[model samples]
Target: MPVKTENAEQLSRADREARGKDAQAVAPLESNAEFTPGPSRDPVGLLLEQEKTRVPELLPVRHGRMLVSPFTFYRGAALPMAADLATTPTSGLRVQLCGDAHLSNFGAFASPARRLVFDVNDFDETLPGPFEWDVKRLAASLAVAGRENGFTAKARRKIILAGAESYRTAMRAFAEQPFLAVWYAHLDVEDAIAQFRSQMKKKRVKATEKMVAKAHTEDSTKALRKLTTQANGQRRIISDPPLIEPVEQLFPDVRVDAIYKLLREVLGKYQRTLQSDRKHLLEQFTLVQVARKVVGVGSVGTRCWIALMDAGDGTEPLFLQPKEAQASALAAYCGRSPYASHGERVVAGQLLMQAESDIFLGWTHVTGPDGVDRDYYVRQLKDWKFSFPIEQMIPSGMAAYAQMCGWSLARAHARSGDRITLASYLGGSDQFAQAIADFAETYADQNDRDYAAFQAAAKDGRVQTTTDI
Candidate 1:
């Protein structure tokens, strides 16, 4: 997958810096502060349009989750913001975007090397677009979350600025590094804790340590103990309705054996996409059973499944998640993805943006019984996964998290975009960061307005919430 500004790599360092300066000259840093939505914009209607692409029966669940709060609504409203971002000025610098770079999207997971690392963990709406778009998405998420947490206006501004400033400074630092150095760069969670350990109180450090310990306990073996039960002397996924429905329950008309056979075939196709080493590793296990699972506030309506596999010796259990990948929300404003399938688009974007990727990461195109084809990407489930407790964060804790997210985002963008040019456009001052902070506050206001309109629609029966399977 080629980036929009790949040609910049051929230019000399001086020339690349000049290109950034030229972009800054045309779109000044202060110009990014403006946020004027067109009069005809209909946020609720935009969401209604996206609803058409999701699983019809699960629509209410998505709506119910989004209606939980304004921040929740913002999570599912990525398309509307993509449209809003189209109206903002760009620096003309493009990168493989996370497209939905909210704070919750950044989390800790085990890298292929078995090291705990923090990076952007979601790429469902990834595509190539203006570098500012991703940064703004991240900054705005902070503002919205801060409001939900009851932070004061001044405190929220400080948190947002911390993220934006960290991004600018980090990009400048990366601009001075060699290509290989930048590509190999990563943020180890342990190292992060050590760096902050000195600055934090004893109780805070202990809490952080406890989180890391908990992550180590999350793996295939633990998942087997929690999500499966002995039935007919064979392991099977437990039925939990709406949230986690077993194959037998989801498709009563289809034979269980045939469903397992199809799952075997899907995994076979998916394995071909992995490297030779990983393909061989996957061959050691046999598929046990699968379950349909609803995950995340924004992804509730997607087709997601968890596959359980057992080693012949019956000791190691492996869990793999195959999730549907639709066309990116950013595709409408930025050009269509260069990849032939949305699955490949997600896998390619994840590989480009993350310092390290899961060994089993792969994509496949499957034809369902309804004669419709869909794209999906596969990865291990609950493998040392952990999310920051954003709702419980104090202002100082959030400020620290803001720095890590910002630094991580800059590193990701630097790998795909021209770092020298972006650094030049940002300059040495805090002007661009200040402008983004302003945009974040304004965008949070827009999110509230959209939430209010959505609530009204719910009253008129345009949307409803239910847990009935």
Candidate 2:
């Protein structure tokens, strides 16, 4: 799957550009305009297989969440789409992929500099793969979301074209720059607001600004206020049943003290993975309480824990989310990851793909309550993380958001893959964008059919779902 031109040292700039152009003859740009499911395709079966490694109780919760809508299903259906993408045409220009590069996966987060920067925020399924695979996933996500929002076909197509074209044009521009320039490029959230504010109505502009303001307040202090309560004079995470269960609730038979003791030891080891400065900073904070948390739809069944840490003074708090990392969905279709730990694989991919990353980003191995060894990556629970409520978004707003995602993705790909090669392959036209739009509509139709089949399976009890969770 990675049989593309990856070694820049072996090829001249002209030769790399020629290689990209020559790929068009092998797999024409327009060849991406169709979607045909293989006869053996069983979306439900694929989903079930993926859920096997997850916690049994949370399986129902995952299915229930995915059962919400086609768009919601698509959000948690990265594995199925990875299977589909493996069958698609490619130009063989490989890059570090946000293998689950759906619309909801792109957003703004606090950079190391404390500035809000937009980037591909989720990388649980990140791996090296054909660059267009991420592009198509992003485009198709917009189509799915548009349909859910009641956008007409013409509107959805226009949004998809805008996004795909943005990627092409951005890549072309990056191809002309020096390596450091491409590496340093980032979309500042404030700049993004400025760029799109004029295109929106006055009311919409105010709402957007309000959203940005809200993100700034979504840090550990906010989590401390919202998710914790005074329990026996200690600030402990509230037990919100399946959504947020204290570790004591999760393993009643096991001693809660013993679990915390082990976790503290694990964190002691995990801190070693960080830089000396970060490790020193972490030493100031002491692990306080931990809760088993249910996160995103696809990751619901995976082991996720919200760890509460206090800086001894008990005035300042730090919340970290330790999410279990499994083998990427692309690993089966592509080759197995070079890294021994899936957690490291995810962190490696994120560092390569994002212009700025969390300062506390690190990985560690943990033995679960069930006695199973699993890899996990840890990051701030929330640090000015930003996500849009696209349900209220209009078509023009979506078009603007799409361009931002496209440009950010291109920047990421340019840093890891060959910018010159991709620029040459995409050329100075919208032919590829048109093809992506065509494929988006076609694949979105397939997603609709699969979503319906999943609904039927749920009705027949082929899959159990507990929406109350």
Estimate the TM-score of every prediction.
Answer: 0.98, 0.98
Model 1, C-alpha of 207: deviation from truth (Å): 1.0
User: Poorest 10 consecutive residues of model 2 by lDDT?
Assistant: 1-10
Which residues of candidate 2, in runs, are more than 4 Å off? 1-5
At residue 168, give the lDDT of candidate 2.
97
Model 1 TM-score on a 0 to 1 scale:
0.98
All models, RMSD in angstroms = 1.3, 1.4
Which lDDT tens digits does candidate 2 get at residues 1-469?
2224457747898998898899898779999786789999999999999988998988999999999999999999999999998998888878989999998999989988988889999999988889989999999999999999999999999999989999999999999999899999999988898988889999999998898899999999999999999878889898888889998888899997899898998898779889999999999999998999999888889999999999966679999998999999999987788889998888888888899999899999998778899999999999999788878889999999999999999999998898999999998889999999999999999999999999999999999998876
Provide the lDDT at 24 for model 1: 88
